[model samples]
Target chain A: MSIEARFRIDRDDFTLDVDLTIPERGVTALFGPSGCGKTTLLRAIAGLEASQNGYLKVGDEIWQDEQKNLLPHQRPIGYVFQEPSLFAHLNVQRNLEYGLKRLRGVTPKVSLKHAVELLGIGHLLERKPHQLSGGEQQRVAIARALAVSPAMLLMDEPLAALDMIRKHEILPYLESLHRELDIPVLYVSHSREEVARLGDNLVLLEAGRVQAMGTVSELFSRLDLALAHGPETETVIKAVVAGYDEEFELSYLDFSGGRFAVAGKRLPLGSAARLQILARDISLTLEHQTKTSILNIFPATVDEMTYEGTAQITVKIKIGSVAVLVRITRKSASELGLQLGQAVYAQVKSVALLS
Target chain B: MFTEYDLAALWITLKLAVITTLILLLIGTPLAWWLARSRWRYKFLFEAVVALPLVLPPTVLGFYLLIALGPHGPIGGLMETLGGSPLAFTFTGLVIGSVFYSMPFVVQPLQGAFTAIGERPLEVAATLGASPIDRFFSVAVPLARPGFLTATVLGFAHTLGEFGVVLMIGGNIPGVTQVLSIAIYDHVEALEYTQAHWISGSLLLLSFLLLMSVYALNRRFSVVKP
Candidate 1:
């Protein structure tokens, strides 16, 4: 399914002008720093904020047009604010039922029973919002939004208000949502780690403007995009289970950069997984070193380079059309005489297995 | 010993306080809600006017209202033309005076409550598909219950203690405009200390009980029951 939106909203201090479109199913993370208008765009889509000119089409349905502004409730969009914001007067059960009752039809996209199970909040149904812990409250909030059977889910920094421990507590439920629900989610977040964990697609926003948009791998591998130039710059590679070495207790993850034998991850055989390799973790060597114990290596060609700090340069290397970043000292570049068209061997120091 | 006039005065006081408190709650509620939420630049003007009676010597307000509701005055003449008698020197006059005198008591508490509620709850209600009015009634009202209780108690007690305004406008008509404050005044005027003590003591007890209940309930409701 395809979603298209072009919106221009003006406020006293903040003016947002964005044009974006996502052409398929997946969790598209709206990633940016604070005050980037991520929440504003989400609000505009939800009809909670009126824009001067906004055109939104989700799947086959037109949700908004400048000529016709649909009210928030009229548009089947579920929004979770930064705060859990459950009705304090209502028990968890009633909070879930609040959205269900709003639906005029007999059939619901998300059944009450299913939502309780999905968020795993059935046990807390009778408890009030204040009675639950922060994570529990957020889960109830998510369940409440899901009960209405929304066409698209708009989550605005749903985890920003939680403590680190609380955020850790609720992340798995979000992972489960991506696995179970096929509904498109527009998730707004400022955390790079969260984006790496959840987003199938990425929209990099900066000061009310779209810096870049593409699949996570595309955005991360594009050497020119600012997203690929910073400390968080990393390539997200989609890999499938090639095989496992039981004796070594390592699993072979096969991707375009060739096979990576990482510590044994419990993922089922043949299940697709996403791996994130940080730019800083990658080191470049001109020759295939036979003495080093570096377990992962791939042959790559130097494509481009950028100076990061006073003494270091970030090199972009391409492997079979796959781009990965490597951080090297200026001394090494001078010693190895690195430049464009130079072939090298890339070594990864560490990799994270994304859920 | 209690005379027919004493009993009549006590009855008038109870009637006036009850009727005035009722009318204030009915009319002041909408006004208070507007004052709480209106973003008009000149909003403080209306707020000043509402608070005038509280600062105005009760006699000054009563004097103006007396002229306004008198048969020869604009309001009284307007009422006569509308097929009603002038309110001057009548039970209706006392009721009007008490409502005016006690308005700030009711309006202030209710306004404070409504303002404290802020826009979050209402916005949440709207997103949940509640219409504007439904949100105000179902969400705003229930959450503002403490304010209502405070307003009711203060309004009733303030009206009960009203004296100068009632006397100026109502003229202390026995069994009609005469209230507990007026009755107590008459008893002391006649040097009947025994009778004055009973009426004044009873009112003191009533106002005290009402205020105590409000504070106690407010304490309980303030914890924000989930």
Candidate 2:
């Protein structure tokens, strides 16, 4: 199942015309700069905007088509907008129950108790929205959306208004919600850090057009894509838990052609996880070095090179079958004669465990 | 402490106030919502028309109403064609005059309530799977509770105080059309100062309580900042 969306809407000051498709599995983030119609697309899909055109299909159901138009309330979709948008009159529990009660049925896909537990809002049930902290309010908002047992979930920058501390507070809940729930989620954000943290699939948008759409690793490491270059550019690796290294109090994570050792973790074995290696944290060597303090090393092949700045250049390399990006000085790159297809080794100073 | 005439006046007052408020709410809600949200270039013109009764002298309106309900006028002619009474000097005519006279009291509060909502809550409700009517009852009505309270009380109280319009159209018939305001006037005209004091003092107290509750409750609710 996939979401097929095609839209062409004209506004007084701006017009959004684009067509895109999203796979029906994990979090597909509509990532873009602000004012690029990312939020408009989300609203259109939710049936909130009537001036929109084209077909919008989620799985087997067509929310909007030339022949049929489903009203927002008629469609089973959970939307968490940028604002927490908790009903001010209702307490946290009643706010959540508002959607749950509307979704009347015998076979409920999401249970009230389970949603409360998942979002950790069980204790905030009786409190009004204004009484809750920003993070707590957003959590309850998500729980309220989830309680509807919608066929799909659309989150439009749910944490955009929060400060860093509040963002950190809500992110883990979002990550865990993604992991625990099986519904298709389409998230929208322009923050690369947020995309790196929560995105399973990425759809880069700019000026009301799609820039790219692929898995996080696929977009992050591809050679031709501009996303793999410049500041905050990083490599996303899908790793599986191998075993625990008790002596060093670290977990051994195994990927395609290398083993990554990180700070100790308590995850169950064989569970999948992600690793993000910043481009600035990686160094390249022509051959294996013995005196290096860096422990994580993998055989790398230069895939493509692009001059990012006068002093620094971005190098895309293959670690077995996966791609890793390394930014090196122009002088160092020239000394090694780094060209496409040249074999080398990547030395990483550190790697971060992304959920 | 009430005479049988005073009781009839009270019943007339209640009937006028209740019917006036009920009719105003039904006619004013959608108009207020539209006034709150419309983008028409001349929308202010519509607002001025709705508020004309607020500043228009009650006698001035009653004078026009008197002519309009007379058998020779267009409205009375239409009623005659439809096999209905001309409606002047009747309780129904009193209600019509009161509805027009008390319209601003009901519409202004309801409009203020809808405008204060600022569209976000309704948009959120729409996204949360609430139809327009569902959201109106489940969200907008509850959110606008204080405003509704104020509007209803003001409409009722304003109708009870109506004198000029009822005098012109209702003709002050004691049992048929004499409301409390007219009854008070009649008592004072007969040199019954004590009975006048009783009736007038009751109306004054009732109006004062209605306005006091509006201010106090609205103040409290405003500070609560829902």
Best by TM-score: 2
- lDDT of candidates 1 onward, in order: 0.85, 0.87
Instruction: Summarize candidate 2's per-residue lDDT along A1-355 as a digit string, tens digits.
Output: 8989998878887787888999988898888879888999888888887755579888888888889899888888889978888888788888998877777563568898898999888889989888889889989989888888888899999999899999998998888988888988989998888888888899887777787878988898876777877688898888998888778777889999789988845577998888889998999999998897787988889988888868998898898888888989999999998889999999999999887
lDDT of 1: 0.85
**How well does candidate 1 score on lDDT at residue A56?**
89
Residue-wise C-alpha lDDT for candidate 1, range B1-226, written one tens digit per residue:
6678878887777777788888998998899999999999999999999999888999999999999999989989999999999999998888888888999999999899989888766666666666677777877788789999999889888888888998899998887788778888888999999999988888889989999999999998877654
Cand. 2 Cα-lDDT = 0.87
DockQ of all candidates, in order? Answer: 0.43, 0.62
Q: Candidate 1 chain A — worst ten consecutive residues by lDDT sum?
A: A223-232
Q: Which pairs of residues collide in model 1? A: none
What CA root-mean-square deviation does each model show from the true structure? 2.6, 2.1
lDDT of 2 by residue, B136-224 (tens): 88888888877898899999999989998889988988888988898888888998889989999999999999899988998877765
Model 1: per-residue Cα lDDT over A1-355, one tens digit each: 6999999988888888999997557799999888999989988888778887789888888878856767776788778888888877778898888877877774777788888898899899999888899889999988888888878888888999999999988888898888788788899999887888889999999889999998888877776777777677787888887788878877788887698878857577887778889988998888998888889988999999888777988888887678887777898888989999899999887888776
| Residue B159, model 1: Cα distance from true site in angstroms | 1.7
